[model samples]
Target chain A: MSRARNIEALKNILIVVLFLTTILLLYFLWENVTMKTFRLSSILPAGSSHSLRAEDVTRPEEIVFSFGAGGVTADPDVDGRYWELWMNAFQKYCGRGELLAEEISRAQFLQLTDYRAVFCRFAYDLPLESFCQQRGISNRGLNQIACVTEMGYSAGSPESVFLYDGRSGRCYRLVSELPAEGFEEIIRAAEQGEYLVYYGAASLFGAESSAVLPLNYSSTLAETPCGAELGGADDAERKAIAEQFFGADFGFVRRIEESQGSLIYMYGYDQKTLTFAADGSMVYREALNGEAGARRDYFEALQDALDFIENYGGWREEQGRHLQLRVRDAYEIESDRQKGYRFVFGVGLEGVPLYGGDGNLLTVEIYGRQVTAYRRCLPDGDLEKWKEDREKEAFSVVGLLSEGYPAIYEALRGEAPPPVPPEGEEAPQEGAFEWVAARLQNARPGLVRDAEREGSLRPAWVLCVDDCDFFYDLYSGEAFGAVPRQKD
Target chain B: MKKVIMALVLVLTLLCGSCFVCAASDPAVTVVNPQGNSTVYADNILISVKVTATRVLKITVFEEKLLNEDGSLSSLDSLEALGQVTAGSLRHVVVSPAETFYSNGNLSFYTKELKGITPGIYKLRVTTLDENGRTQYLQECYVVVRPPSEAKALSFQSEQSGVLSFLQSFLKNIFGN
Candidate 1:
C-alpha cells in the first residue's frame, strides 16, 4: 500500500509541473503577440513656422505725448540748417505750436554758436591767420568772423571747436538767440530757480562781440539787434513777448480729464523759461543754445517712458515692492525692446489674463454672455489687494480662473485653445488639454503611437511633465508628484 | 509465491523511480555548427559542441569508423577520440583530423589544419555527460568535403562576363542617360 501511494504521488507531482509550465508558456506567448506590435502610423505632423500675430495679444490702453529738440529732420527747406528744422518738427508733431517751435529754434541756434566758438579755437590749427589775411578778412567782427569760420570748417574735418576749449583755458562760448514766446510760464511751473538767457554770442574770451554773423538766420539777426533778450522783463511783459512772437496759434486739447485713459506728463527745458498758454502750447524767451523737452504719444511710447521710470529712473514710489513681487517665484516676461518687464500673475482657462501685468485689478461682470475685464490699479503695499478689490466690485464668479494657467496647461499638454465660437453659438466639446493633445498627436503620430516612426524621434514630448517628476521617475520608476510641491 | 511477486513489483517500481530521478537531473545539450548535412574538409577542423545544465557539463568528440573484411576496426583506423571537453562552466575542443584516417566504409581525418584534405563524406558524433557521471545527450552530423579545384573553378566562372555584369551595365546606362 505504501509503494502504491508513493507512485501515485509522483504522478500527481508530474501533472502539476506540466500544468505550471503550460501557464508560463501561454503568458509569454500572449505578451509577445499583443504588446510588442509596432504602431508607426499614429505620429503627429509638424506645425507651421510663422511670425507671431500681433492681434492675438493685449495692447496698452493709454497714449503718451512728448516734445524734444533732437531727431531726424523731416523738412528739407531750413537753409543749410542742421538741427533747427528737426527740433521744430518734433515739437510741432507732438502738438506744441509755433511758440514751442520758436523756443526750440532759438535754443538750437544758441547751441550752434557754441559749436562755432569751438570751431574758431580749432581754426588756429589750420593757419587761419594766413588764410584770412590772404582773403582780406578778419575773425574779429561777429558777422564777418562767423562767415569766415563757416567757410573754414567742414562737417567731416578732424578739427573740432570743443577739442580746443580745454587746450586754450578759456571759458566756453555762448550763442545769442531769441527765446520762444511763452518761456516764463514753463519755468515757473518747474519751480527750480531763476535762470539767465543771454541774447548775444559770447566768446571763450568772455567778449560780448556782435562781430560774427549768425551762420543760420543771418537776415533775421540783422533785423533784430541783441536778438530777443528777456532780461529785466516782468512776467506780464514775458507773456506779451510770447504773444507777439507766436501770434496766438496755440494747439492743444484743453482740460485733459483723468478719465480719458491714462495721462503721462513730461517736463523738459529750452534755453529760456518755456511758457504755455491755457491750451498747453509752448513758447520760450531769450532761449539758450540747446532745446530740451520731453516727448509723449499714445500707447507703446508712453508705456516705454513709464517703464523706464519704473525700472531705471526710480521715479515710482512702489517700484521696489513691484520688483520684489516680480522676482518672487515668478517668471518675468520683458517687452521686445527690454524696456518693460511684465510679471505674469496668473492665466485663465482660455489663456487670457485674469489681471494684466500692469498691476490692474480685473473684475469680471456678466450680465448675459459677455465677459469684460474691468481694470483698476491696485492699492499701495498690497500686490494681491487687487483680488479683494475685484471681489468687492460686484463682479460675478462665472468661472474659477487665473491669468497664466492657460500657458501652464499648454506647457503640460502641448497645445492651446481652439478658435472661439461665434456669438450665440456653442463652443466645441473638446477641452483645452484634449485639444492640445489631439493637435500634438496629429502633428507627430509617433509621439502617441506604440512605436516611433521614421524621422519622428524628437525630444519635445519630455516637456509635458514637471522637471522633478520627470527625473525622479526616470531614475527610480516612482513618480515625484509635482515640482511645485517638491520642496514642501 | 505471493512473497516473490511482491519483491518483483517493488524492484520494478524502484527502477522506474531511479530513471525518473536521473532524467530530472540530466543536463540539456545543444550542438551549434556543422548543422545536420554540412560540408567540411578532411584536414583538421575545430568541432565545437555546447552542453548546458543547471550544474556542470562535459563533452567528448568521437570519430566512428567502419569494419574491415575480418569484421574488425582496421589498424589504420578512421574512428578516434579527438579530445575531451572539461567539466566546467563552458568547454571547447579542437579535433585534429590529420591524426585520424578513413577505414573501410568510414572517412575520418584529424589534424590541426584543414588546408590539404581530399573530398569525401564523414560523420561527427558528440556526447555530453552531466556532473553526476550520467550520459545526458548525444548529437551527430554528416559533413561532405568538396575538392578545392571545384571551388576554384566556381569562383573563376563567377568573375567571368555573366548576367550580373550585363544587368549592372544596363542599369548604369538607364540611370546615366
Candidate 2:
C-alpha cells in the first residue's frame, strides 16, 4: 500500500510539472510572436553620427508686390528737356555718379494722355523708420505711402503744383520756395496722418518743383471752350445721342461753356446702369466719369493700367515716347454683376502712328457717354528721337530702383560687414576662418580632420570650413590648413 | 528510492529551464522592409512597413539609403547621388511612425513619379525588433523596373488633322454652330 501511494504521488507531480511547463511555453510563444509582428525599426537604415555644416544649407526669402496706376495724363512735352534738370539733381543727391545720366540719356520715354503712375516699394534689412527718414518722409497709419504731384506750366505764371495724397485722396497745392519748408511741413503732416502722398510732377527722387504736364488739357478743362466745334446742332439731339450711347439711365449732370466754341457735356450714370469698355486702353477717371460706388473700383482702373503695361505687348512699346501717339476711345460702365465701379478704354492698331512726324492731326470725340481721342503721326520727324529719349528716361528712374539696391545685392551673397573690435581692446589676431576652425575643433575633437578625403567626405569638410575658421582646400595638397595671418 | 526521486526532480528542472532559454532565443518580432529598395520617388516614396510581433512589435525607418556601386544598399549622408533633374529631381524618402505596436497600425511608402526612378533592380530591407530589444525579423524584396511613360505620343496624336476635324465637327454639333 505504501509503494502504491509513492507511485501515485510521483505521477501527480509529473503531471503538474508538465502542465506548468506547457503554460509557460505558450506565454513565451505569444510574447515572441507579438514582438516579431509589431517590430518596425528594420525599415529604415541607421542615421549618421555626423552633424550638418552651415555651408550645406541655405534659406531663401521670396517677395511679390501688387500695384495699380491711379490716374494718367498724356503730356506731349514730357521730354528729356523738362526732366533733365530734375534727373541731374537726383543723380547728384543720391551720389549715383554719371551712371544715371548715361542710362537716362539712352532711355525711351512716351507721352500719353491720362498717364498715372503707381509705385510699390519692397525692401529688406533696412528698418521702416530708417527708410522713411532717408526718403525725407514720415509714415502715418499704413505701412506704405503713395504720393502724386502734378505741375502745369503755362505761358505766364509759375508752374502750378498739385500734390495728391493717396491715403486721403485729397489734393494739396504745394507752396513753392527755396528750402521748401512748406513741402516739408506737408510731408510731416501727411506722415502723421499715415497718408500715402502721390507726387505726379516728376519722378519721386527728382526736384520737388519740376513736374511733368499732360499733353492734352482738354480733359482737364473746366468747361467746353467757346469756338470749339460742336458735332450736333441742338441740345435735344446731343442729349438724345448721349442717352442712346450711355444707356437710358445716363443723364447730363453739367455743361460748362468755355471761351472757345467748344461744347462740353458732363454725363452721369446710376451705379446699376453702366458698362465698361471692352479694351482697357483709356484712363480710369475718364471711365468713371459720374459713376459712383466703392473706391476699390476706381483703384481697379489703376490695376488695369498695370496689367496693360505688364501683359499688353503693344502698350509697353509705346510707353515713354513723345511723337508717335496712340489714343484710346473711353467707355464707362458698372462692373460685371456690380463688383463695384469699373471703366475701360480701347485703341485700334490703325489709330496708332508709327512715326510722330506724320502730318496726321488727332481728334477726340465724345459720343453719348463715351469719349475717344484720336491722333495722327507725322512722317519723317523728331517724334522717333523724342520717343527714344523719353523711354530712356523712364527706364533710368524706375527700372534700376526696382531690380535691387547695392545693399540688397550684398545681402543676397550672404556677405556681412566685419564685426567691430571691442572698445579699448586690440582686435583678435586670427581671421574669421581661423577663429571658426579653432572654435569647431574645440567643440568637436578631430571631427574636422578625420573625415574621408574624397566624395561624401569633401562636402563634410566644406561644411566644417563654412561653419568654422579652418580652411580646407579640396584642391591643394594642404588638407586642413589653418587660415594665414593677414598682412598689416 | 531517494536517489531516484532527486534525479527525477533535477531532470524536470533542467527541462523547464531549457524551455525558457529556447523561447528567449526565438525572435520575438519580424521587420518588413529595409534598404529602401522598394523603388519610390522623392515626393511619393515613404519608407514604412508592416511590423509583426510575437511579444510586441516596434518598427521604424531609422535611415535612408541610396544605390551604391555594387548595387547593394549603402548609407548616404546626402541625396547627391541621385543627380540633378533639369527641372528638379525627386529621390530618397524617409519616414517613421510615432508608436511601436503599430497595433497603432501599418505605414505606407508614397512616391510621386515612378519615371524618375532609374531602370535598375532595387531592394527594400526592413528590420523589426521586439519589446525585449531582440531582432525578430529582417525582410527584403526585389523591385523590377519598366520604361518611362511617353506623353509626347499622345501630344503628337492630338495634333493630327483627323483628330482636329473630329473635334471641330463634334464641337459644332454640340454648340449648334
TM-score per model over all chains: 0.17, 0.17
lDDT tens digits, residue span A1-488, model 2: 99999999999999999999998788557433333222122122222111211111110011011011212222111122223332232223323211100000101111111122211111111222233333433322212213322221111111112223322333322212212112222222223332222222222211121222211111110111111012223544343333333443354445444455443445543322211111111111234334433333222333333232222112222333322222211122343333331222211112121211111122222222223222211121122211112211111211121121222223323574344343334444542322322222111011121112311111011211211223222222133433211100
| Chain A TM-score vs. truth, each candidate | 0.15, 0.19
> B49-143, model 1: which lDDT tens digit per residue?
32222323333333333334555542111111111111221122233321222112111111111324334434454444445655555445544
Per-residue lDDT of model 1, residues A64-89, tens digit only:
00011110011111121222222232
> What is candidate 2's lDDT per residue for B39-129, written digit by digit as tens?
3211112222322122344433333345445656544322222221111222233334423443321211111112134333333334455
lDDT for A443 (candidate 1):
7
Number of the top-ranking candidate, with lDDT as the measure: 2
